[model samples]
Target: MKPLIVKLGGSVITNKRRRFTVKRATLTRLARELSVAKGPLVIVHGGGSFGHPVASKYGIAEGYKSKDQLMGLSLTHRAMERLNSYVIEALQKASLPAIAVQPSACAVVSGGRIQSMELTPIQKMLALGLIPVLYGDAVPDLSKGMSILSGDQLVVQLARELGGKRVILGVDVDGVYTVNPKTNKNAELIQEISLSNWPSVEKRLTGVVEGRDVTGGIANKMRELLALAERGVEAEIVNAAKPNILKRAILGEVGLGTRVVAR
Candidate 1:
């Protein structure tokens, strides 16, 4: 079996309502869930409160335009690193050997996107029975001078370059819903999404999400994740906060969450 590319959604792991807070109990639960994955697991976590707020304040996602963005770059990277440290520590406490792979150090960015990645460090980390924990980060961009690469986008890049057939996103919500579940009591969960229903699904997926998310939320993720499926990588969006949803998804258990079809 290929390595499972698992993304721990920021909202699920971080207490975004507060500044720089990590839900330790939530992460501990997640670590337990991820422990059951049958194949080698590559863990990528969102920056959560640690990343989004600073990036938003600095406009890091807008691509570099001024020297002033440099301070923001350092601040944003440091914030993300702080979050990564918490995640790694929690996983380690769960007896999962994990090491942090700082994205900015190893990934080459251009035009505010990952232009190239040096995979030897990551490949070697997995080979050593240590799971490499990566997160959304700021990196040098040729076109913009600097850009914030989101965990969502990093999932695709890692899966593509590192050889993963299954991509999983563990979010706070059960799965994709017709409306933002937080705001609408009448929101409906859609079980399976493919090209067949995406046109209609896309229309119903609109709503403003509350958070400091620099990377676009679920709606934006759907498109990139679907494109990943089109390349023969099957993806799932599950409620990672719920017990065993992540484990079940990794184990290929159906009826748990929304599955992005592999076409």
Candidate 2:
């Protein structure tokens, strides 16, 4: 069976308003929910408060320009690892065989896009019934010295390369909305988005989002997921902050969140 790819959005897993603060209770609950999955799984997570704040502080996303940025790159990678540790610990406590796969260690990019990655380990791990966890990180780039690899982009690459069945993005919002849902009470939820109607939907999407997300935020996520849709892979953006929602979404329940389709 193909593995299901689940991305734990930064805002859902961490307190984006605070630095290095992991929402332990929420993460544990989500991990427990993930433990119910009966098949292979791959978890990709966002940087949120941990990595995003630090990355933005030193302009890590713009790539290496000065010798000072080398330290920024190092700090950024360390922060992501720290966040990944929390995720790995939570999944382990929930009895899910999860292992952290550092993107920086195995991936090289050019212009903030994946160029090559060592996937044999992840493939073998999946074959052994272990869930491989990955996240957005700063990685070496051919065009630039280093770049930020967003979890959204990683989901697209992994699903396509590993032939994932479906991708579920566990986000703070209930689903995609006409505007920034957090700030706009009038924003309407967009339950279904497809390639044909995406242009229209795109016009209504506001880039205004919470946190210091250096990785292009929700708009970039939509673009990335749409690319996956173009290849016939479907994805969902669900309110992972809600109880049982992530579990249900992983179990194939529909109508709980926004669904992005190829058509």
Candidate 3:
């Protein structure tokens, strides 16, 4: 089996509005689920409410040049670090032998896109059977100077580099749906999505699906993931709160989630 890249959403880990109050019990369950997984696994998480608000306050939404923006960016990164530490601690408690490998410390950016990802240390960790946990962070960029790289984006890079055969995003929602399940009782979970139909599916999605999704919400994530699918990587979006979903996917069992695939 190829490597599995798991992206845990901050929203699923904490209250959507508060990132510091780590949901210990939920993550404790998640860590336990991942601990028993087989072969190499790479875990990545979002900043949730922790980094976004602070980064917005500093006006670092895109790029930062001003001192105020820089200050805010610093706080934003610290917030990510805070959340990262909590996740790392949880994994350790579960005896997963996880390591916090900060993306900013190694990645160099050009323009607004990722120019390259070193991933050497992560590769070494996987080789040693150690899980590498990465988080969304503010990183250096040549075009805009420093920019925030969402964990979702990092998952794409890592998947490509590691030749990840499976990519699972654990989000608040049960799966991608035709309508906001919170409001529409008739809303149905989309079982499979192709690259050709992603845009239309994305446009129809609403509620809780917004810019804040570190995994880029339904649309952007589908776009990014479909591209990866074309390269032979399989990706899915499922409810992270349900620990069984992760295990089922790893076990190659038919699951209740959205599978993004090539056209």
lDDT of 3 by residue, 80-145 (tens): 999888899999998888899888888887654678888778888899988899998887777887
Worst 10 residues of 3 by lDDT: 207-216
Flag the better candidate by lDDT, 1 or 2: 2
Rank all candidate structures by their lDDT, best first, as comma-separated numbers. Answer: 2, 1, 3
lDDT of 2 at 54: 84
Residue-wise C-alpha lDDT for candidate 1, range 179-227, written one tens digit per residue: 7788889888888888778888888876423243777766777778788
Model 1 quality (TM-score): 0.94
Worst 10 residues of 2 by lDDT: 205-214
Please provide TM-scores, in order, for all candidate models, with all chains considered together: 0.94, 0.97, 0.91
Model 2 regions more than 4 Å off? 207-212
The total of clashing pairs for model 3 equals: 1
Clashes of 2: 0
The best candidate by lDDT is: 2
Q: What lDDT tens digits, residue by residue, belong to model 2 across residues 1-263?
A: 88899999998899988889999999999999998787889999999899998888888889888898889989999999999999999999998889999999998899999988999999999999999999999888899888899998999999999999999989888888887777778989988988899999888887343344788766777877888888878998899999999999999997788999978
Local distance difference test values of all predictions, in order: 0.84, 0.89, 0.79
Compare candidates 1 and 2 on TM-score and give the better one: 2
Each prediction's RMSD over C-alphas, in Å, is: 1.7, 1.3, 2.1
